[model samples]
Target: MKKIVSLLLTATMVLGLAACGNTDEETPETPETPGEEETLTGTGEGYGGEVTVTVTMDGDTITNVVAEGPDETDGVGTPALEQLPEKFVEANSADVDVIAGATVTSRGLIYAMKNALDPDANPWPMVEEEEDPSNVEASDVALGFGISSLGRKGPGADDTETQVWSINEVLASALFDGEGKIIYLNVDQVEVATPNYDGEGMPHLSGWPGQGGYNIDEDHDEKVDGVTEDTEENFIAEVELWKTKRERGDDYKMGISTWSEQMDAYEETFVGMTVEEIEEWFEKYTSDRNGRPLKEGSEDAEDKAKYDALSAEDKEMLADVTTSATMSLNDSHGNIIEAIRKAYENRMGLEITEAEAAGFGVSFMPRIGPGKDDQDVQVYSLNQVFANTLFDEEGRVVAIHVDQLEVASPNYDGAGMPHFSGFPGQGGYNYDEDHDEKVDGKTEDTEENFFSEIESWMTKRERGDDYKMGISTWAEQMDGYEEVFIGKTVEEIEEWFDKYTSDRNGRALKDGSEDAEDKAKYDALSDEEKAMLADVTASATMSLNDAHGDIIKAIRASFENREVINLSVN
Candidate 1:
């Protein structure tokens, strides 16, 4: 009877449809019999571990699902299994979604099916839900990195005081992500103020009489009635010079005759700056010490102005260039280490000997040499590189041994000049002291012209003293005289030289004041006069300049592309 009733209703519905739709062109596709979505199955890679899930469905609804895990814990993964089945059922008409913190497992289950048996079933709805994987809780495993010692000190508190220097540097490196960094730190501990002096380093401070002002108040009759204070009369005079040398590195080498000149420059230029401004400039950049922009609200405006000042291609090039605060933190660390080392040496009663102090000077200390895991006791310093060597009381070098040797400036050949082996355009040259090598008709290459062999490679139009003689001589010798001479005439060359000399002379006339006076002199030169100082070395006729710098730069840039070949020495 139920079949008969269904037949009658089907017939009536067919008749009604036929009567109504004589010419109906847009009709929904016929629906097939209800079927379950086929469960998907595949291996899924996850940060935590790999997982596999299987699902079961009925018609358009998911009746059941099971998730299996190899590494997943029961308590942690059970939540995923429990919540996912319900989530899957709730999204029966739509694609499956992954739960936060259980994304891998949720996804593993949802994607387990190859295709939906139900045509309306959506494939992946987790994307729309946007679940976060970071929410998953997990135990953190310790990761280790290489560590090297930064400094040295005695055992116990003094040792800690010394080692703190290196530890601080490591912390700083970790914070900065390493743009420019010091290789390592040197540290030492100075024991001061024994019970005899009641913790006030009085005797130690009083060692240098006029070096440190000693005030003895005999009338008061205190336990230790003497106090030494740093003053103009006895203070470490020119602490400023020491500071400048440490910071500038090799810029402060001075002659005794030029003492007045240096003092005058320091007084004039430094006097204009307030202590606050000086400190600010000297202070290194740190994350905690970040400062607001000079024009904070108008940063976009400022950027636009800068952008407008440059070409489109330059703007694109600059897009990759990160403009951020460059910290002098490394210098600060060096300063701290040097100060501590000096103080410690003073305490040890190890007089840094005269012979040891011969050239520039050297410090004495127990140091570990390079290529040693265990400390190799030795003395080291920046003497030979930056200055001369110094010896200690026992006829041994009092140099500070360092893990890294950045200032290890080994001298070049017989000439006492520092070696620049790794520098571009510096290598590949031989010299004869007593020769006036002619470049074309001019005696341009002399022993003083070191980079003669590499002049033809440079591309920059405006060359420097490094190129002036060497390139011209090379061009003449190489039968490339016409090539070199095509650019500028003899008059033009003379004019360029005159222009350079005139500029320098003008600066000299103003007493080389790094102030408004020097600027006034530079501004006084006419445009035509300035134009005369061109790189006329390279004209259509000949190259007065060598392109060695350009060649070396290109080689350096393409270094990454070069294939490395390993040859077995052993």
Candidate 2:
């Protein structure tokens, strides 16, 4: 009876509409069936995984959206997922403002939404016309980046002292005005183990995480403190978890203020000064012990009190800066001043008007050369790559700064200058020319060189000509390679690497390789390919992906994770 009543009502409504139209062939456009809502779903690729977008639409307008990308990074991608869904609804369109430091995830969410709304209309790979860079005004400002490392001793197994490699970096582009004054800066710090660093350093596999992960149950896969199984997965996981002190943000407890807050205070204090002036300012006001601003009022008997003591005028000059950043920016903490000074040395012509973004990246990988060697003589090597890039609004690289560092255990030096390949529990020897015997850097520890050897892990850029790479220094070659990176997109840079590099060893295709396979591969390449990379090979012939460094990975990541900023070009 209810179905018959509904059929009668529907027929009556149709008859009324037909009477108003006065035509049998006329049909009315149904408006979303009145009070009915439609749900849609779409997916797109994210940084480390896939992003799925679900939306409920009220007619043609987006009423609600939910984006999920569980595999995205904790601080980067997760934030985007939690934040962008609301923005999608507010905009009522797939196009929305991008979240800073998560460009890859932003694209994922946008594309997913586009497909969800109308896959047929929007297409899977929607292309948009790019705004020409020439149409935008050329910028007058330049930018730079830097990282520095100093080592110290910390507690090891039981109560013994182990080497702790302290590393600090400033990414920032240190946006400079035409007069060469700094207008912007971004700083962060991370320390790595020099054999076995304390819990304060980078996410060390065998040192801290290994110790904890080893005890965390059967499901964990890390190589625990020299006991668990070692694999590439373990190292990669460690790298993935590593974060700078600034990235740690509020998690890096400082009692009075966060690490980022302290750095921000200092960054603000240093702006408007040239690098030379900054050095002069540091020389006059910073504490010798902790690198904080000199204080005038503390009278306690501690070493810090003595370091903090200052005269009236000197303290007055630093009065403004001292209040906000009382913590150390030194080896005791993070050497931000030194990093900035080094940054000035590496400045490049990167013009950007309020529309560009910058990013800093470091590729750290542990290298263990397997096969062939005595168990009595071996050491560990840590290769680190640091890069800072400025990206145009069109997503092309505007400028870049890159440098690399290789640090080894003291025992590595004992092996030889070029190589100390062995398989073991031993330190190399230093030769005594007059005595014609193996000296200190010897198997046993000496009073003088023990502390000295542990505290000096220098970067290649600092070593300069000393880090000889055939006819060019490591710094010179790195600069040359950076020129090739400029003006290309990240995709282009990656494709260039694939085209010019050797798959076997991950280096440029060279004629003088020790391996016959590499030689054959180089010979097999067409003349066009060889000529394409000729300019690069002339300066940088070393492997970009081998044990030396992982530069391409760093380059890609710099773009993947960038912070958005705005400032007039000079």
Q: Best TM-score goes to which candidate? A: 2
Q: Name the TM-score of candidate 1.
A: 0.21
Q: Per-residue CA lDDT of candidate 2, range 429-461, in tens? A: 322223222223343333234334433445677
Q: Estimate the TM-score of every prediction.
A: 0.21, 0.57
Residue 369, candidate 1: alpha-carbon lDDT: 20
- Cα distance off (Å), candidate 1, residue 460: 30
In candidate 1, stretches whose alpha carbon ends up further than 4 angstroms from where it belongs are 1-43, 59-61, 73-77, 93-97, 113-368, 371-570
Question: Model 2 — TM-score against the truth?
Answer: 0.57
What lDDT does the true structure give each of the candidates?
0.28, 0.62
Q: Looking at candidate 2, what is the lDDT of residue 2? A: 48
Task: Tell me the lDDT of model 2 at 329.
Answer: 65
